[model samples]
Target chain A: MSRRGLLIILSSPSGAGKSTLAGRLRQWDDTLQFSVSATTRAPRPGEVNGQDYYFSSVADFQDQVAAGDMLEHARVFENYYGSPKGPVKTAIESGRDVLFDIDWQGAQQIKNSDLQEHVLSIFILPPSIKELHRRLVSRGQDAPEVIEKRMQKSWDEISHWDGYDYVLVNDDLDTTEDRLKTIIAAERLRRPQQPHLVDHVRKLQSEFGDRP
Target chain B: MSRRGLLIILSSPSGAGKSTLAGRLRQWDDTLQFSVSATTRAPRPGEVNGQDYYFSSVADFQDQVAAGDMLEHARVFENYYGSPKGPVKTAIESGRDVLFDIDWQGAQQIKNSDLQEHVLSIFILPPSIKELHRRLVSRGQDAPEVIEKRMQKSWDEISHWDGYDYVLVNDDLDTTEDRLKTIIAAERLRRPQQPHLVDHVRKLQSEFGDRP
Candidate 1:
């Protein structure tokens, strides 16, 4: 019998390199399926319906919340967003590990939900705050002021590190990615994840009686 | 301020490919150190001193036992074997992850010892018993009768799968090995493992004064 897939929640500060590692992990492991969150915010240019996010109206987002269909929902800055329980549950039941690349608030909400036990939480941090600031500025994505704001926000994000089951420091990109890959592989091998394979091993043993 | 290293225990039946994986992991990450077990058993041919096993004497072994110097020890099939407490403590204190390649019994003993808090148990299994049997027979070291005995022994080993905190099936050696590498890397990044790194990150924000 196939077991449900693992729910992997990965959280990291803006410059901690989790997004890159998560992307590489998905590229490396075919079994992993990314969790697409639905948000009330308007899609930016080049954002696809299913690729970037599932765009929803404010009322629709609230409706999912009231209907208890969203696994975790929150209002961030103005817009409401949530992980739809349907797609996540379906993917998991089909034997694909679903990855939730989200923040602490979202992860905490998921943890409080029924899906908490299935969740494997990981929080990633940069090796140092100097490194975090350097990486953020080097990216050239944000103005110095905006980058400074993100640095401030990182502490608030990282403060919830203990709430996660695993933590990672983005020391070097390649090594950090490699480490993420190992955690996923090891978790998949966890006994709860492979009962069928264990039974298969037993059946094979029974076939070969000790031939002394 | 260095954080503590994670104590990872990997238990698997013979020929399940843990030794190779452990070696590769250490090769990939300089920070990971393997726990060299101390034993009273005579070293086999080609075994180097302090490499394959820390060769010790019966008298010294007894002294250690009396002093409770071992994290775990046992008399197995006519030999006394134990994991020494001193070096492991030092390695962990120095901020290096230690891998324990032992059987379930040794893992249990280590868990029962003071190292339980740091221990992360992982059990590896072959994808199928048929595959495991094939691997055992191909080695050709065991006679046909001995192969049968080992296959039988594998059944007993498989029974303890539940005792592990994580399980991995060695279905594809390369893939599984890569997976294990991630597991170790991720566990090392745990929050408790990097308290100093947290402080280091915070210190940068204070130095930059919201500018950098």
Candidate 2:
């Protein structure tokens, strides 16, 4: 009996280690499929076409949106980004878990979709704002003003923490990773996810003298 | 800054290995307190007071029930049985998870109580009714008629499987135990169970310049 895969959503603010944890989870379980999002933005240097982002023209991305092929989509700074429904559906039906690194809005859209029951959303929080600021500055990618802007946006993201099924205070990396793995393992056993249980329970009923 | 304990309700049909699994869980984590039920029935030979069951008089049991000290209670064969509220309240308030080996009816009562959010109910299912019957026969303690009656009642217990927060098909003891432990570990991390999260989030707020 093949089990249906989980749609794992990992969301966090800018410096909360969501990407790092997602990477570690994938490395821990090679079978997990990382959702490749479709985006209208041009690929950055060294970014592979299909791997980093499913590079799409604005019209193509909008076509996907109009066709209802996008599970969740958002407009960021005049560029469109969205999760493609096809790969996620295929992976889960084949019993492979799909991991999504998206924000709260995207998480909500996924949760409200037809595959709502399959979604397992987790929100990661930095230990403290001081730690968050420290990490953002340490990244060296954004300027101080840009860091300040991101710090302001952090609160908005943190406010949505309660909406997730599980929340992790990312104080320690290893511990958080272990907790995430435990959540995924337990969720996989949920009755709705294991459709084969119908046949299993039917067999048990027959053995109990329900049938001659 | 203390966390509240979980009210873990484990229910299973006879021969589903509920008691064996409960014992193994306690052995694995000594900190988990096993709930000792109060009963008006006379102690069986070798049953210890306060250990096996809190042997109580009918009047005393009625008094406790009137005082709102019984979390859940029921009448069985001209005797009263119940879970005492005092010890469970103290244990959970002091951050000790309490395990209850009660049926679906009791599980429903506890879930509908004030501590509903703290409750974690799990139902165990045997791999097959044939296996269940084999295990009951192997015990060699019950008469064939009693075993047959228990077999008849198994479906009644199994029917309530959907009422629980989690359900495990006990196909293998070791695997089932591992899954149970994982569920507990993840549950402990739930935000409502961790009161210290209030202070943690406050600290984060101050660090974000929300406080002077």
Candidate 3:
């Protein structure tokens, strides 16, 4: 039997490198699937409907939520966004690991759901707040006031770091990516994930002597 | 601050190749310390004191046990053998991982002790009982009856495989060793194992704006 896939949840403060690490992991293992979240918001100019987000009507999103189609959902600035249970179930059942690039609240909801045992949550930390601020400034997209607002929100995100199963400090991008891959490889070998062991053990039992 | 070392307990039945893997791990990382057990049995002519075993009188062994200096101890056919707490404590505090080659019973005792949080237990399984038997027969030093007795005990060992934190099938020695190293590397990054992270977070807090 094929091993069941893990639901990998990666969360971090805005300047931390979770998105970069997630992208690297996908590049490393092409078979892994990235979760496409359903959202009520309008698609951006360059965004594809199903590939970027499962763009949906507000009524349709609510209906799916009520029908238990969402693994986890949240309202953000009058827009509903969620991870659909159907696609994740199909992916994992077919032995494809799904990656989630959601925040801590979404991670918590999925962890508390029925699929808690399959979740592997990781939190990435910026090496220092000075570095975090420097990175935000280097982006050059945000004004000074906006950068300060983001700095405030970063701590709010970092406060929930303890809730994760594994924590990584993204001081060096390559090293952090390597560590994340190692974590995924090890989690795949967990006993409950490998049901084929039952048959292997049964074969061993048949080979035992009758003297016992 | 130095990270505390993990107490790695590797358990496997006879012919499962745990010993060979353990030796390879030590060779792969020379910093890892092998746990030398204490015993009440008389030392052999070639045995070096403290290097081979901390040879002790039965009364001395009992005294150490009563004093809570033994991490896990057992009596087998009137001889006492145990993991001493002192060496392991010193090694871990100084940032040296210790390897324990013990049975399931010893593993259980160490896992239940005060140092439970520091322990990482792995159980190795042979790919098949036929393969395990073949490995034993190929050794050529053991008589047929002795090999049969070991085969009986192998089943008993395999029964407790679920109790380990990680399980690996010894299908390929190199692959199993690589997986073991990966598990250890990821485990070292766990938040509780890295106390210096507290200082890192505190620095972040100091740099935060008073906007909250």
- Candidate number with greatest DockQ: 3
lDDT ranking from best candidate downward: 2, 3, 1
Chain A vs. true chain A, TM-score per model, equals: 0.86, 0.93, 0.93
Give each prediction's root-mean-square deviation over alpha carbons: 5.5, 2.8, 2.7
- Per-residue lDDT over B128-153 for candidate 2, one digit per residue giving the tens place of the 0 to 100 score: 88788888889888887888888778
Instruction: For candidate 3, write residues A85-171 as lDDT tens digits.
Output: 999988887788999999889999999988888898999999988788888889887788899888878899998888888888899
Binned by DockQ into CAPRI classes (incorrect, acceptable, medium, high), candidate 1 is: acceptable
Per-model TM-score on C-alpha atoms? 0.69, 0.89, 0.90
Backbone clash pairs for candidate 3 read none
Report how far residue A103 has shifted in candidate 2, in Å. Answer: 1.5
Q: Tens-digit lDDT track for model 2 on A1-212?
A: 46899999999998999888998998999999999999999899999987999999999999999999999999999999999999999999989999999999999999999999899999999998878888888988877789888888988888788888788899899999999998898888776678777777778777776622
Residues A73-129, candidate 1, lDDT per residue (tens digit)? 888899887899999888876778899988898898888888666778888867777
Q: Which stretches of candidate 2 lie over 4 Å from their true place?
A: A40-50, A55-69, A210-212, B45-49, B56-69, B210-212
Model 3 TM-score on a 0 to 1 scale: 0.90
Q: How far out, in Å, is residue B112 in model 2?
A: 2.5
Candidate with more favorable, higher DockQ: 2 or 3? 3
**Ranked by TM-score, top first:** 3, 2, 1
